[model samples]
Target: MAKLTLPPLPYGYAALEPWIDEPTMRVHHDKHHQAYLDNLLKAITGTEFENVPPEKLLAGLGQIPEKIRAAVRNHGGGYVNHNLFWETMAPQAGGAPAGELAKAVGKEFGSFDAFKEKFAAAAAGQFGSGWAWLVVTRAGALAVYSLPNQDNPVTGGDTAILGLDVWEHAYYLKYQNRRAEYIGNWWNVVNWTKVGELYGRARK
Candidate 1:
């Protein structure tokens, strides 16, 4: 049976330090993310989805066996969300994107700063444990939205090019209820290059 595995961080735990903190990264990846992956694995094991890719399984939730569909949606969504979360950030990678990605953002949101304002608002305004995302709509346009819990945009035929986890566990240890502060600081670690790459692929 094929199984989903956790991918190692591209950089050390401390790579995004001073902004995200080392201890948070350690616990987030080792415990939280691992639990999601494990639960996702358990949810699909021995089922027809056992060999299906994460993206396919998530994008086709309606087809999942009814008994384990919820479990698969929550855990599998977490697994994929965390994977993109980690990949879209890096040690010293925060900066504006260039080229086609930049053009798209500018065209969609008027300006990069405008886009940041909208994205940040979405991330901070997400009511509870959920995620805010910059996704490629089915129509191939950029859009910002927030989804509650582990609901991924893929389920709606959208591609998430960038995402921010607003779940308290993602920042409470360090931000201590200051989600706005955490959200602001998170921009420093965003890997625009990676996001641009995802955007380029999603458009195709």
Candidate 2:
């Protein structure tokens, strides 16, 4: 099987400006995310995992060969998660959920502000490198979850509808030590259209 390749950014590196700078997006996507794609491919070379799609590899980490499991879990998760992360925002996105997502948010948390508070708290409270997620439970309920380094809600059977990369590298460039500010600004770029689409699919 061929090795996985890094996907191009959906928009220009500078597209996310102000909220996310050009140089940061460039390095994060080109260098860091690409390294994960390369390392994951290298780790799976000549192994059964070589045939697995990068996204599927992340969804089934425990089933990978033990010799390369850790590499796949780390690098593969990074690759998949970052892929989703990049598409989860845009320079023109964010503000508030819309359509069914807005209604769901209203029903789930009473209002959008409440949801934001919970999500921000979850992101800020993560003790170390990890991600914060808005996921749909198997029972069709929405919930907030935080996972440590490369961990995702998929590992626990929850379907991630949207997520935020809370790793220091994700925010250090712009927010410095103020992680809350980073989380707050992140709300300004969320691609609610994509998130609502994912939520619909997950609910089905």
Candidate 3:
């Protein structure tokens, strides 16, 4: 069986300090994310789901074997979410989108600050244990939504440009119960370059 493996962080552990401490990234990536990958790999053994790319599996979760479906949802979602989360951020990154992406944000949300306020509200307001997503809806519009547990928007026919994990585990150690503060500081590392790339792909 083909197994999924944890990918190395693009930057060193200490790369995203202060706003997102080295300790949090270390534990979140090393322990939590790895555990999900390990479990997902084990769950797919001897199943036809083995060797299929995770995005494909997640985008078509209905077709997976029922026996291992739950494991695939939780662990596979974790695996995919963490990968995107890491890529969506950078050490010295942050600020609003530029060029075409900036224009789209203006069209969709009126202005960059308006978009931030709305996105921050979604991130801070998510009930509990979920993610805040900026997705390209099938209608070619940008939309914001939240999902519980490890559920992803791809399964609902949307492409996520960016996502923010609001689960306590993502912010507890550093921000404590201040999910609002975490959401605020998260903008400091919002890799708009990558987000623009994702936006271009979503439009296709």
Candidate 4:
């Protein structure tokens, strides 16, 4: 596989502050995300799968050799998941989506408020470390769901347009045990414009 480097955050560590803290972004992106990429590189180096593109790896997991599949699944998913996590957030963002994405949300969940309620519920109700997602299912319908560990929707033939990292590492420093508050505040930093782009791409 071509070497996959960590993508830099679009904004400074402090950009999303007051919603997501500076210290957490620093640790989450620099420490946690970097570790996942490092482990993924180790797992794929010198293997047949080494030449596969990073974007194709997760969807092709079944074809990966058994010895390194678990590493690829966990670490690779973590690496890709965090990439989207960072890209889909920005400073001073938040508010309902517009245009096509807005129509889809309304059509699928009744209204944006209802969608937020369902999405937040999925995020807060996730039993342990996991992610909550707004994904395009195989049939090309919008859906909300959560996955365990570092699992990705791609593995199940769904395309995640928006995702929330509910892992303690993502919010514990600022919100402590209040995951609900973290989930609620997370919307304030959500890059809905980017999410709309992803939704369009997924629909295509």
Cα lDDT tens digits, model 2, 86-196, are 888988898898988899999999999999999999999999999999999989999987898887677677888888999988888888889998888888899999999
Model 2 local distance difference test score: 0.86
**TM-score preference between candidates 2 and 4, better one:** 4
State residue 84's C-alpha deviation in candidate 2, in Å.
0.7
The lowest-lDDT stretch of 10 consecutive residues in candidate 4 is 47-56
Best of the two (1, 4) by TM-score? 1
lDDT of 4: 0.92
Residue range 1-204, candidate 1, lDDT tens digits = 445789999999999999998999999999999999999988888877889988899899999889999988999999999999999999988989988999999999999999999999998899989999999999999999999999999999999999999999999889999999999999999999999999999999
Q: How many residue pairs clash in each candidate?
A: 0, 0, 0, 2
Question: What stretches of model 3 exceed 4 Å from their correct place?
Answer: none
* Per-model TM against the reference: 0.98, 0.94, 0.96, 0.97
Superior candidate under lDDT, 1 versus 2: 1
Highest-scoring model, lDDT = 1
Off by over 4 Å in 1: none
Winning candidate number (TM-score): 1
Clashing pairs in 2: none
Q: What digit string (tens of lDDT, one per residue) describes model 3 on residues 1-204?
A: 336789999898888778898889999999999998999889986777788988788899899888888988888999999998999999899988998889999999999999999999888888979899999999989988788888888889898899999999999999999999999999998899999999999999
